[model samples]
Target chain A: MNKVWWKILGSVLVIYTAIAGLLLGVPRLPILNESIRNLYFHVPMWFAMIVLFSISVFYSVKSLSSKSEIDDIKAVESVNAGIIFGLLGLVTGAIWAKYTWGQFWSFDPKQNFAAISVLLYFAYLILRNAIDEEQKRAKISAIYNIFAFPMMVVLLFVLPRLKDSLHPGNGGNPGFNSYDLDSRMRMVFYPACLGWILIGYWVYTIRFRIRSIEVKQQAN
Target chain B: MKKILFSLLLTLATVQLFAQDNGVEMADKLRSDGKIYVVVLCIVIILFGLLAYLFSIDKRLKKIEKENFPKN
Candidate 1:
């Protein structure tokens, strides 16, 4: 509630990015052409997803140490928000790839790893649901969350870089790094990441509040 | 030289895409006519509408919590 201004800023930034991203002139690279504009919509989803998942892992660590119910609630909500963003990123990436690469699923290293990492999170949700007792569920899932976060990082960030990837910056493929370093694209891209990440957090906060309310209701 | 050639091909590709799709326009006309505002407007409307729904849910949840949970 007190952080309402940031939420407003986030929404404003997203809208601004959307409009500007459409109208702004890009480098006119081959294969990308106008679709380079997807940088605003698609790339931000992954940034937001990673931010949310990191928040989830942080809270999982908190719950493990402090053993607080609120911490677990925060963890679960962050993961829920994270999964939503990850799925959005995947779908958008697929659409962009289809228009450019001539296929929906190219089995690109980045894409394959991304799919596996998302499945890892889905497995986290399944693990959570498999447990019945509240504290037991929280502790076990928190552990699974902590366990899963590192593998996801390796899957998404580290491994992709190590191998030949269709994505930029990997396998010697020219990626955003080529244009991202010195271009007007940076002007919109960074803000887009911040905006989408804030929006994800806003959603996470609301989900946490709702779950907290449910917890109180159950108590009564 | 390579960049120029690639750009030329890409431009043709975009043009070909526009030329091929008639019944299902790719908004090429809208973009060329500088009427992308229409697309922007529609997208902004959808984004704001979703945010508005979230805002309403937040308000309702707060009210329910206030009514159901005693203040300590």
Candidate 2:
């Protein structure tokens, strides 16, 4: 009863956004046209991914300090959840780009940097698998997780801004707030981001619970 | 002075009706004929269906937990 409300809210907000996003009016801009509705669905995936990745890093730091296996389980599960959202963001962004930017993979700084950051996390996962022992795996991966997180921050946030790119808020491009997004869109957009982030957290918790059960079974 | 400010704000608000950008073509035909709801229906169904699938998995995990672990 206590934890269920937000999960229910996430589902409700997502459904509301899907309906309102399609039916509600949007700002008319060149190239985006009707596809501006992608703002509701596509943008939320990255917001959710970023939120989950931040959670993963926080738990990694906790596991390093506390030496708790549960913290390590949380860190790994959050990463797994984050990766799913990241891939969704990448594919949806590519599809949106193809319609608007002429090519699916046009070497846009945002796209390239995004792919690299995802690969960096994947490397973290592989690094964990290579170690057979639990304590060594947790500590070493926590170090790597902490180390890689700052570089990923640079890759996703700063590097893209330094180069010419088609992504909003990059190079000379205007952001949604500057043009496409208006007060009406904000009504849906903010809730959509909140909904997706909450859903990502929900998925992470479920995965954490399942992993904990497995660990307990193994112990017994 | 209060009346002047109120009138000015009202005028500013109404000016948006005459903004310069040309309006894009909305799917007026589909919306008018009510087919746009079909698209909305499909999207809602897909979103809810995925959520339902997740809930089922959660139930299965709960069952496993009950079977194997010490109940609190």
- Please identify model 1 stretches exceeding 4 Å from their true place: B1-34, B69-72
Q: After the best TM-score superposition of candidate 1, give how far the Cα of residue B48 lies from its true spot, in angstroms.
A: 1.9
Clashes found in each candidate (C-alpha, N, C closer than 3 A)? 1, 0
Give candidate 2 misplaced runs (Cα > 4 Å): B1-34
**Model 1 residue A37 lDDT?**
87
State the lDDT of candidate 1 residue by residue for A26-101, as single tens digits.
Answer: 7867887788889889999999999999999999999989999999999989999999999999999999989888
Docking class of 2: acceptable
Across all models, the iRMS values in order are 1.4, 1.3
Docking level of model 1? acceptable
